[model samples]
Target chain A: MGTKRTLEVELSTTGLSPDGKPQRVPLVVGGDGGAVALEAPPAMEPEFEGEHMLINIGPQHPATHGVLRLVLELDGETVVRCIPHVGYLHCGFEKIGEYRQYNQIVPWTDREDYLNSIGNNCAFALGAERIFGIEITERCKVLRVIAMELSRIASHLVWLGTTCIDIGAFTPFLWSFQERENIYNLLEGWVGARLTTSATRVGGMAADIPDKWLEGLQGFIRTFPKTIDECERMLTKNAIWVGRTVGLGVMSPVEAVNYGLSGPMVRASGVAYDVRKDFPYLDYETYDFDVPVGSAGDVYDRFLVRVEEMRQSIRILDQAVKRLPDGPVNVDDVRIILPPKSKATSEMESMIHHFKNVMEGPRPPAGECYVAVESPKGEKGYYMVSDGTSKPSRWRIRPPSFVNLSAIPKMVEGHLLSDVIAINASIDIVMGEIDR
Target chain B: MSPSFTIVHPGTGSNATPVTPKNVPVSGGPVSPTAEAVGAQFPGVISRTVVSRGETTIIVDGARVHDVILWLHDDAQQSYDYLSDVTAVEHRDLSLPLEVVWHLRSLRYRRFIRVKVLIAKGAPLEVPSVMDIYKGADWLERECYDMFGVKFAGHPDLRRILMWEQYKEGFPLRKDFPLRGRFSRSEQLKNALAANPEARYSMEELSIADAFEELPLDMRRRLSEGEKVGE
Candidate 1:
């Protein structure tokens, strides 16, 4: 067998520095078997070092995943600094929530983080329910748990597919999206909407799962893990995937917590701070599931963490389906829950209750509450303040993507320009949430 | 009724099993232990501690919120290492003071606390920025400033985040700002049309290369004359 020879090319160009000095980086090629490397001159010229080129990516580019614009300062192919600009998709969702009734605001939550719209609905309902001091039925609690877990899997699937596409793996993208479509089918069957499933009301869900919906969910639960296993078989040890992802954007445990990274982003840094476990809600404490933690907080670790989370979500869904209770989906409170449609037309009291519920809306006592949930992205929270009115005095969305994306400049600074895409994909940002 | 779940801070190496709170009161419950600890550490700093909806909100003086938060982060007993959110609340009642809220969490001990500073009506809507404490505050503080016009004093790069740099419609989340916006439809359109798209690239960004020199003389003069093109 012939010996393989490695070619090393160190090609550089000369340009004028900001101070108008001639800056030259001479090209040198290795003749012997050597690896390709970009090497700077031992006695580097100050003018050459000072020549930093600025490039803008997106606000329209595909690699950004959304309308996110990033202005990068590059020294050669390495990123010197990255300044992200968002809000191109800003629609003032929070500002609008202040004017709408609590129930009306649930639909708007769907538009912010569209991938996790059902999870957002649940989080907002939990916050509003806390303020209203309403205890949901046992059936409602288990159903919400099911809804949240299903949406978590769906959101993670989107993240998996889109991130695979970003990193140049097309096969996994198709397989993941195919499974995601299955979950969407189940959601559409339940809520009559897929992408924007405003499935939960303030005190309970909009409606319970229809007849035999559990069968469909059980089918998904039984088959989804095989798809995840197939994805893992394809990409877990693939050289290109590992080369592009591992150790590219490393964040320490302290840095992850300090920067307010949450969900997989924080857990990947070995922080074990899942809101479902640390601050349980919707009977999450009663469920048995493991919060996956990764030692190295890199792009690969984030990928592994998210894939494991999808599996864990399936586990929760399986348990929820088996333990499904039989009862009313909404709270029994007349002030909040609308009267039954069958009774509303027949009874005057039911008609009056329905009229007042729709016209004036149920007013919670004057107070404020912040409810945080373990969203697919991170700790998704909805903060609401009611000044003794049907509408909120202030409505704030503690968007996980917005906080997670803030750490991008720190992660991308010293890496190659191409790694920026990998780091960003790992962040799994939905710009609708960030700009809202 | 009080909250059924207690706010228990676990000891080192011991994990605490937290359950969902049932029957949480509308107001008043078991206050977070940090509230009292913070109140004790900073005697005159904490004005009041309100337990509402099973959450503890310690109202701190506007001037000392940074100090109190710093202590919470540094203290072993109250290791609120994670900053959950930085936002402001503007009430519909115009007479009431605007409130700056910080949601802090301790990953180690599994605790959460809300720190608030009330910026009174007619007073400067400025709060000491926690950007120094939490790097995540960079954009959150900027967004708060953009939406509520609340200034974060020590923030290094507090600028309009969700809004354009030249946005002059006043803060969108403020009580006085109209829902449809300040200007009429035609006027808003005209302003949007007349906006210099070139100015969208900030002066600092343009200075990165020779792009700054390539700008028109009039635009350059206007930018140099302090037209506010990013921080």
Candidate 2:
């Protein structure tokens, strides 16, 4: 390696310099293997030239769906260089988690990936459980499976609705949302919150599932397949949708793996690696469901994979509900989880346990573990290191969106600018999770 | 729960019996030598008293940070190939200024370890970028750079992320930085107005007006009256 040098250069707009005159100023451009200098050249005006035109999509555009902006360098309609500028909704979630207790972080997880709050809750809960070596009850696992599957379906519905809108199909958005509202109702009945479901606790669920809530979920499961069929009938073979997606932004299996792509992105590229199947966590191994993979590796393939996944999630939910045991939802270990509110007021030991757990938190054996689960977006992994403390000494989330979004430049390198929207929608990025 | 067990290496084609619960100890001693080296190489790097657990972390000095990281990654015996994540801890009140941590794992050995580098608040607060060995370090390094302002010397792109453009004044994740939202207008909007002063209405003003028009009549009146919009 050679010694690096820093350079300082000045950039000034041709206008008043606070004194109402065209004055030059200095700008710093630090780099290595370079020189530092400033020179006054002939007063020649600079014009935006060249075939490539710089276009800003938005920090507030309909297609972005959230505060996401993309600066595209386009040669005619073809994208030359694309840069995804994020952080319009940076809440510093991980930093916030540092201050909150282990259980308190559950609510924050919901907001990180609002579309799949249940899955987010599961990931965080499982990570914390692994750290503390807490064994969740079989009933808790079954309930988690049911909730996560429902969340998967709801997430896919939003993806379908918004993706259709992105591709100029309007009616499907409303239709999908109508069905999605039913699933949200089911979620609310159980979690007491629809979108931001802070449902899961460190050792188990925050509470047991009510019978009526389970009944409603069973009803939803029965009716959801037909709704998925209705969605497919509208968009699957539609000439416009087929034309827009069939062969656009294709990525090969090798490239997908190299880029660390997961979920629908890798499935669309013909790899059959789902964390649920490959690395079973939360009793997912007991459930029999297919990991739907695609062959085309195009935007259409991604769309098809998600559509099939919703059906598979329904299958898993059906099995989970049927096998859901009639027993305590939480483990018997009172050291990790809190006692019931009623017990805390009545029993002395329970009160002391709650106080101790809240004040000191569960001291996880000094250890480190990496737990990965299949979230709606992709493989969401939490790599946690604990130093025998209540809080994680180091908690690093390997967000699927961040990894999946990395492949965006590769996906759209040679494609047209318009195709970028299709590619972005296909990736299904939630910037909250990505920026966290 | 039962203590599940397996023999590490059984004699050729011979079946190994599972270790019985009666034979199992309440706790076991540290098993891996690599783990022991982790403690020996940097004695005081970790708190002296070691806990008997699956994972152990060693906090190294910022000056020897690059060497320790390289050893963890490239040492033939250790072979910690995968760089899982890199994040920083902002302890403004700690004796050491700040801590930058890296979690490394070896898929072959089925082992995981943590290496931390501590830096004080000063000019050139830099750590060597592990991006050369682990491609995954690219974003993790950038994130640490963006949030904690911990400079990774060889990182390809060291610009601020998760913050608005031209937001260079402070590292938001630092404990001292207030959690409350900033009240100042964006640099882009301010510069735009400064360039074209005749454009009297600010972007915020226009957005508010548009939002008001879009809302239902009852809601609009409530918002205008300063009642909570969601309520």
Best by DockQ: 1
Q: What is candidate 2's lDDT per residue for A269-359, written digit by digit as tens?
A: 7777576765467667678899878775778778989999999999999898888888888878889889989999999999999999999
- What's candidate 2's DockQ score? 0.08
State the fnat of model 1: 0.65
What is the overall TM-score of model 2 with all chains considered together?
Answer: 0.72
How much lDDT does each candidate structure score?
A: 0.84, 0.69
Question: What TM-score does candidate 1 get on C-alpha atoms?
Answer: 0.89
Q: Can you write out model 1's per-residue Cα lDDT over A73-191, one digit (the tens) per residue?
A: 77777787788888888899888888899999999999999998898898899999998999999998888888889889888888989899999988889998999899899999999
Model 2, range B1-231, lDDT digits (tens) per residue?
211112111112223321111211213545445657766766655443222234455667666666666776677667665565677875535454677777665433435566767676674668898877766577777778888778999888766666653454477676666555343558645743433222122232233334446544654675577643210
Candidate 2 residue A354 C-alpha distance from true site, Å:
3.7
Best prediction by TM-score: 1
Model 2, position A86: C-alpha lDDT score: 69
Question: Ignoring the other chain, what TM-score does chain B have in each prediction?
Answer: 0.85, 0.60
lDDT of 2 at B14: 23
